[model samples]
Target: MKPQHPSVRRISECFLKPDIECLPQESKQPYYLSHWDLNLLPIQYIQKGLLFRKPSEAFEDGHPFMATLLHRLKRSLSSALFHFYPLSGRLASIINEHQASILVYVDCVNTPGAKFTHAALDLTISHLLSPVDVPLVVHSLFDPDLHTAVNYDGHTLPLLSIQVTELLDGIFIGSSFNHSIGDGTSHWNFFKTWSEIFQSLPPDGDDIVSISRPPIRKRWFPDGHGPIINLPFTHSDQFKIRFKAPELRERIFHFTKESIAALKAKANAECGSEEISSFQAMSALVWRSITRARRQPQNQITICRMVANNRAKLEVPTSEDYFGNVITTLKVSAKAGEVVEGGLGWAAWKLHEAVVDNTKEKFREAVEQWFECPCTFRLDQIFVTNSLSMTSSPKFNIYGNEFGMGKAVAVRSGCANKFDGKVSSYPGYEGGGSVDLEIALFPHNMANLEADSEFMSAVSSPPHLFHQ
Candidate 1:
């Protein structure tokens, strides 16, 4: 078999804003952000995509095939923005010298609008997914300029960019969204709405699409601190950094339902308790395997900064569709030897306890502390640290997002916020509680993990799962 070199050529670029007539009066004003939203470095954007198999309709050429779909995509997305209006807004700063603080907000009045791009990939779906590892060419499917940066760029750059790349037998809808606006739930919710609208569009295209699960457009905040809160910094430039990441290799490993159950059973048997969940067991397995692969010093600390959604933990729980960032990173650390020798049960137990301890009270206390004195994130030291960050939960509905064409064939992410020791988990395409981990590591560490017998023992070869 020959290696594939995917050739991507741009067709068109445009900015799509929310329909002003459909926009509620409340959304027309400056939308303030929560501390949960502002806590992240403004430069980071969540870049991911969904691949849809080619439609059943026949066409003489690829250009006309795309030309037909583009009309429908634009209409549905514009309708999606009507509910997710804040995504089209720009990030603005308001400095108050007397208060000695700066306020960051979504400047709805001056929205640059979301960037929409159409492109052609001279390749087939099989050619795209033939590799054991995620192909590097997949990154080119997105707008490259919006990678890891402080969200402050929203002042000028489009806050969201959706690139539609048409392949021979499939189409990949890649989106670059600023992290300042929301988390994984918010990101997927936008896509879910867009797909639903696309499927529901009437032939005439005259009626406004009614939202079945309308987004909770209002942002979340603790009492008295917001609807509007000021950051400790006076200038946005203080958050900027020349973030240079090490060249890391990315590969995905698939865990079957049987394998996940086996891992959970093993961890529970070792702990003599059934409290260990499948997620914990699988995460622990990765942590231990990666620690061994890195060959960190026996006495050195190994931490898994597990990212958890804080939506349900809030004192006054908001709806699941809350349209903002509500998340926290909890750490579970142990000596490298302990993590390796303690067996999967011990590591999993630690993770389960940390998750249980992240109560709403704990989250609120952390927020209040941030209110006293704020600190921004610096991405330069991410790869240098001896810690690993687990992002994207398998619970997210990655496989269920269906446009008029069909449900996604495979989900892929871009090269943003990517560094050594970054493990992103997604539910397998086949469903039934299977898991797929998109893992990244330095070249040598990745090689060691690829060859690690214990890690490879539970991973299964994937099947051909894509369809129209």
Candidate 2:
């Protein structure tokens, strides 16, 4: 694909103040992390799109619609931040004496405000809606450098950063956040709250409580665990292997309701069980297809790591509004030859079994074991060297967030630079039971997967391939 060059102008950048005048200040307020959070010790922020098509009314008059829209957006976001105070704060490190050395504790403290970067581009909404390469289009819509940074001493970057770009006939709202603060569920809740506040003004104005589920500041600690402040985790020496995904390209593949049903039927027939879900079927199909495309050695293992939402499954119930990460990875694997010989049904059953195996008791046991060690995560060691992993749940109501405008046309994950075999799934923009899979693979592998007739069969093409 030929490279695309577009002009993006940085209009203005500033820190928007929260609407609340006073915030409760505890000299040292610590936020506890679950075993799941510690495992993903250092994760790139969740960067995704909140795309809005051009409004119907033309702006031929002297009024500048872009400026007006931005002003309204800024105002509403300020109000939303008042409810999500943690996002407006920063993560601080507390050093205390442990055994022979020092221990570091990351506490949520200080308000530096979320960074807001506003820019405009010459590109049109059609360019984004059309069939364009992921890098060219997505890179321009978002600021790739906008992510939280952590130093060795544990001094961390801001919890949140947002970029609002104005494209001709569309608006792109991009957000990135520190994973230590929350997970996808928390991310979506903040956006949903912002949208509600934006859509409907508080009856008493911005002074009253508006969010449906304002986040709870209190952190949960399991039994036998007291105010655990120190994090002894460290990245493994095999860090290079964790990010070994080479020169890769990304493509968005769509699966319609019919295609999903066909996959489920075939998987169920193969397993001789009607209990396989659409997600399980789709996951199985993709895993098998990718393994085939990669054409790994027969003795090698092909693994699939599915990220599970542990909110409802946790032994202790966390408030729906509880802030912080509550997720874990469920892994299934087979020898490369085993996967090739077993077919889609075999792969799907493996995935289904893994999900069922993560019972509440198992989750509790895992947490209990984590306390015994409590070391920081070494990302590369978490999963098998060349395994495939998927994040971002399809259950998140990303499409429903409408900030006084219409629903977003699409959603995207910002971890574009991740290693190969990383995939994120979101509900398709089109309504029927469908899903959009964002896949990242080495260039040759991607080309091979695209050419595979069986894999390509379920993928729906874009409406207009306007590329010249």
Candidate 3:
């Protein structure tokens, strides 16, 4: 039976509004303006699901759930435009007039377990529905394609493919904006909101949510610290250098709280130092793993970049929800030989010192200095560890983010692929207190890192690791 709830015409009527006269004025922060520009393009990508069908049931009626989802999407888009200007920004460009196509791909000639299908969807639906605008939460067909599956040596290997179209599972959705309007967190928030609305839940009321406000005063003029790293216009001949195989990459890793605590204890004991947060300890382990995998001798400088959310640190308005990319990068450099010979505990202490010493004021100064400096110095990699202390866990039910489909299995940043260095984070995993640690790196580097015995042993052994 077809699910019927709201009329698309009524939803459209609710959303239509007069267009803004002009684009918002660009801020002095070049990074801010760059994000604005990126947000204008309709990005795309594919999301796969393993669909279970009963033997007595036939898929001839098509996916009613998906159909209902589309109907709700159209209505939500219209209502969103009527209620919020930012929502309108998502639909300014119409990529497809009708509902997006859904394609089914059969595996193993006529296997009975489950069927695989791809739905062409737009980021607009995901954006307006989520609770935050974190780039990772904005699922669409336009996001970059990372790789393709290939069979080799009795194992399926991923082939690097920068071609976005090939990455599509014959599904597409349209929306207007580039990568700049919001980050992964913002996108996730939007999806949660949309889901709530779709399920007839209370629309995001004006709750007293703590959002970072925009800067009240201009801090300094641009000092040309380095050239801006803009997205490349030319396509690389070999995708290997540009894209990493997504399958081989474990997007998320599970670790129990107890195990994490034990690792921290071990790290503190080895360093002969005071206690450090789990983030710092895990970062040390990752750094050791990466350096060891590369087999670089001691004394060679390896960089670890840490991402800091500047919502509270910026001189922005207290009321403003300092949205978009309010993130700053902090770098820690150490010799591979020092880490290898000294062990992870020593590395953890050094990392702790570097990160703690560069708190709020120091970060503010670093940003100012970067704007003033003329030299470009990009870190080789990044380590991010988000605790439940900041963002509410999906299990907490602090916000009704279930868009008829329940909360996401995982959430991450979309911008991870854009950097030369790897980006890793630990979001709360399912199964209660355990957490999922996500890591991204270049293919060759990731392959080497996975082969290390010490790192693998530690990751696979009793205390620290849990297979997700």
Best by lDDT: 1
Q: Tell me the tens digit of each residue's lDDT in model 1 across 1-468.
A: 747586789889999887676778988788998887887654478888988887767345555666767888888888788888888888888999888788888987676689999998888877767777777789889887776555777788887899999888789999998888988889998888888888888867454689788988778777767888787777776766656556888888899999999999999999999999999999999999999999999999988988888888776788769988888788888999999999999999999999889977888899888878776666664444677888998888888777767777788999888888988989998898988899989889999999999899999877576632
Error of 3 at 442 (Å): 5.0
CA error at residue 410 for candidate 1, angstroms? 0.4
Each model's lDDT comes to 0.84, 0.69, 0.38
Q: Best by TM-score, which number?
A: 1
Q: Considering lDDT, which of the candidate structures 1 and 2 is the better prediction for this target?
A: 1
Better of 2 and 3 by TM-score: 2
In candidate 2, what are the lDDT values of residues 1-468, reduced to their tens digit? 675658678777776546434555542365554555544544555677777776655346775777767776777777777777667665554444344222333443445567788998877766665553465456555555542332221234556777888877677898876665678888888888878877776534444345677776565667767455455523222121223234667888888888999999999999899988898999987887888889888889888989887777655676667777778789887898878778889989999999999999998888888777665555555534457887787777888888655777667655533557878888777656788888888787888788888789977863232221
- What order do candidates take by lDDT, descending? 1, 2, 3
Provide backbone clash counts, one per model: 5, 2, 67
Candidate 2 residue 100 Cα shift, in angstroms, is: 5.8
Report the Cα lDDT for candidate 1.
Answer: 0.84
lDDT for 169 in candidate 2 is 68
Runs in model 3 deviating more than 4 A are 1-63, 77-179, 201-251, 316-320, 370-400, 410-421, 431-433, 441-448, 458-468
